[model samples]
Target chain A: MAAVALKNQLNAHIASMFAAGFLDKQFQELQILQDDGSSPGFVSEVVGLFIDDAEKITGLIAGLLDQPVVDFDKVDALVHQLKGSSASVGAQRVKLSCEQFHSYYEAKNRDGCVMALALLRNEFYDSRSKFQTMFQLEQQIEACS
Target chain B: MDRRRIRVLLVEDEEIHRVVARAVLRAAGVEVEEVENGAEAVRRVRESGAGGGSGAYNLIFTDKQMPVMDGHEATRQIRAMGVATPIVAVSSDSLPPDVQAFITAGANDFTPKPLTKEKLGHILAKFGLA
Candidate 1:
């Protein structure tokens, strides 16, 4: 019964994310790929990597911004990487945030870039929390099964 | 078009992407060899020679923005070595300029990232490998 409850909660949380535009069809594609491998926790594993990558990249971006002379190109490169990584995982909001971040850097708008960074950071944390919760629920289901 | 005999070299820096690509390709009965960056890709290709010979790859899929060496530079170097294997650019950025850059650098084709089986099948068939 507990397992069933956890499963239901997982389903609801996923639906909420999808409905909120935090995820897209690409997430489903990742899930499908999970079945093609021996590792059943493939999606969770990838999600975990995405979070770690985001943290590192965002930290770098923050450090770059704090410098006296912001090297926009370096920050843009990081944003581009984060964009691709987020897209790969179907993190819709984070990818969109990266795009906005890139645009500000391109325009050489320091203040705008700072704002975009905040947006991207917030989206990353939100998605990270959701992913962890979803993975924990999945682990419960696996154990009970 | 014997899938089992088809060999590919996949160059991507990100671990998750590499894992996904390997699983997807293997499931389709295609043999895949992976490398982390374009420099390794160049070394691997040179080591194998060309024309899908015993140890050579039949095709190449390289990510655009990798450390050590980017995909464009790698493609140019491979072409310079006269390795005529079809090199396809695999990236998330499909902008015209991005696509043009890879092509100018010697990639025969371009495929957007977050690779799907359908997309992979289409690319393989286009190259007469499927």
Candidate 2:
């Protein structure tokens, strides 16, 4: 693809991500991740990590509510990692979950923490594969450009 | 154990999902006791998971979200109260992170929504209780 066409495609994906509430401010920060024109894998790696982080956060939340063991730090780390990765992915809703998860934990609000956990569930549940598909397309545009 | 008479709890809040669960699980040759809310499920299981009689239920399939008591809270409470029943959660709400939520809340495994026989069987097999 021509550089101009690739850039147009990239802009279009960013727009879709914004409309879907899957990409926002943090992704903007990531848009400039290339240092002296680094590999597009920078973004791909970050997006891959976001998926892994989502899986881990699931574990941490379970630990939080489990009996005979409540692993707060596990939950916290998962949320923190999710925040960083989603920010890089420009996943708006995931980043929002991370933010709220941290806010509740810091406040020592048990109910809030639980609520945030549920909210996080909804964010992922609500995100269709199309959202990720869009992200992948953007990755392609970056590479081709 | 008689395959046709094993007691099983169907924990779900959605009416349509509950009906579907009942039809599918029962067809598999297990007696299913359905509960629409998590709090009620915990209560039912507490009275049932004691294993005093031969008719006791050994398994459960619960939905993740609901009013009054979500699956996570119900699972946590049931485990804390000594119900040793293996729980298999089936919900649209199941994700990798949510699986951890279910386990932390005392569920044994997670199955994605639009439950399938293969997934259900797989969950039962995981605990060696199939």
Among these predictions, the greatest TM-score belongs to 1
Question: For model 1, which pairs clash?
Answer: none
Give lDDT tens digits, candidate 1, residues B1-130.
3545999999999886787678778777889999999999989988875623323787899999899999999999888888888888989888999999999999999988777788888988998888
Candidate 1: residue B93 lDDT (0-100): 83
What value does the lDDT take at residue A47 in candidate 1?
85
**lDDT at position A62, candidate 2:** 60
| Fnat scores for every prediction | 0.44, 0.00
Model 1 backbone overlap count: 0
| Model 1 chain B poorest ten-residue lDDT run | B49-58
lDDT agreement with native, every candidate: 0.87, 0.66
Candidate 2 residue runs with Cα over 4 Å from true position = A1-145, B1-4, B49-55
CAPRI-style class, candidate 2 = incorrect
Residues A58-119, candidate 2, lDDT per residue (tens digit)? Answer: 66676676545455666665675555445445677976777778877776566777788888
